[model samples]
Target: MAKSANPLPPRILRIIQRRRELGLTQEQLARMAGFSLSLMTKIERGAADPRHLAAERLLNLSRVLNLPFLHLVEDELPEEEAETPPLKVPLYPSLKEAQEKKTNVFVPLASPMIPLGATPDHLAFFPFPGPWLVGVGVPFLKQTGYLLVDLRPLYHPQGVMVVRFGEHAALVTAEDLTAPKGYLLSFSKGLPPLWPGDYNPELVGLVRKFLVDL
Candidate 1:
């Protein structure tokens, strides 16, 4: 079959190949690589945020697949940017606290986060090592389901985000995913977003993957 003029980068293709060569399912790879199965799927599909794929987890994936780090990401980088160091993922205070204590990070189900300074309140906590929780961004426990949320502000185009609108929390989609600080399109006119206002939205976190038990 003729390949499309625009093909997935060789880096992504190799990840899929190597995982299959090792006879590992995406979930197995996720557990081994210390990330989420959803993230593994996204990585293979070339849909994850560049920052997520460029962070240390990718390095872990290379190690797992017995491949060099650059083999998976070199094609994604520009010539001048190739030599730049990998981006360091930041841990939210909650995650940092969890990592320090060697326990599952407690995720709040509905507490709205103040992205600038104050911490959001949590209604309850779930103890999953965030298998996908330990990715490029900080993890917030705001949603009920085990959906993985990225705190780094990295996101997909027109992605869903949790934000503090005045005193309450709102799930808002990005007006333009390219700019993290861009305006957020709101769902209703009764809310603070008010039809794409001129101001930047305060971000709580970006939602990506989720897990649920039967």
Candidate 2:
């Protein structure tokens, strides 16, 4: 009699193969996926289930492998278990505070810059506070409200600015400082702490710039 093939999902095999193709050790893959090496090893061995963000991490790994996202889920799900929803836990106390206050945090709408996708629930900061404009994406947007701002002018001036969206706010910055003063302005209408006609462009810009930079 012929033996039946192993029943693990394609995602598991893809993870194993992709890790090898990229020359990534399990430790490297784990760090990229925000998981521990032991956890990754367990999943590869089929000793654990990949649910919620685990699935997302697997998807991301597939991307790094240049494989199709659905390639990981090629097998039918077990009849008894349905796919789980994405986790919406807050990663910071400020997000929790914003949610408790029932206020929304404003964030830049850029897809790559926003970790929670197009519609985020937490307020996120950018440029991550440094000499250079480096930034980190986060997933705590579900706990706070979100908004997007256009920072084209600021980018030219190497200037920074702040703006409010619902109950949350963000600071934006540029890489150069040669842009004209007052060239940047908030365009969000009906936003609170509403910048009156006499708004302090420099101070507002500085405040918005520093908050996220920190």
Writing each residue's lDDT as its tens digit, candidate 1 over 1-214 gives 9766656677888788888999999999899988888888887777874245544565467557765556675565555443443322222323333224443333322111112232232111222333221211323334333434454444445555645434434444544323444333332344343323443545656555443310
How many clashes (backbone N, Cα, C below 3 Å) per candidate? 7, 14
Task: Show model 2 residue runs off by greater than 4 Å.
Answer: 1-5, 52-68, 74-194, 197-214
Q: State TM-scores per candidate.
A: 0.33, 0.36
**Candidate 1: deviation at residue 165, Å?**
59
The local lDDT score (0 to 100) that residue 205 gets in candidate 1 is: 60
**Candidate 1 TM-score to native:** 0.33
The model with the greatest TM-score is 2
Q: Which digits, one per residue and each the tens of the lDDT, describe model 2 over residues 65-126?
A: 55444445544544332233232322222322433444342222222233332234433333
> Lowest summed-lDDT stretch of 10 residues in model 2?
129-138
lDDT of 2 at 163: 34
> Which candidate gets the maximum lDDT versus the true structure?
1
Model 2 residue 85 distance off true place after TM-score fit, in angstroms: 24
By TM-score, how accurate is candidate 2?
0.36
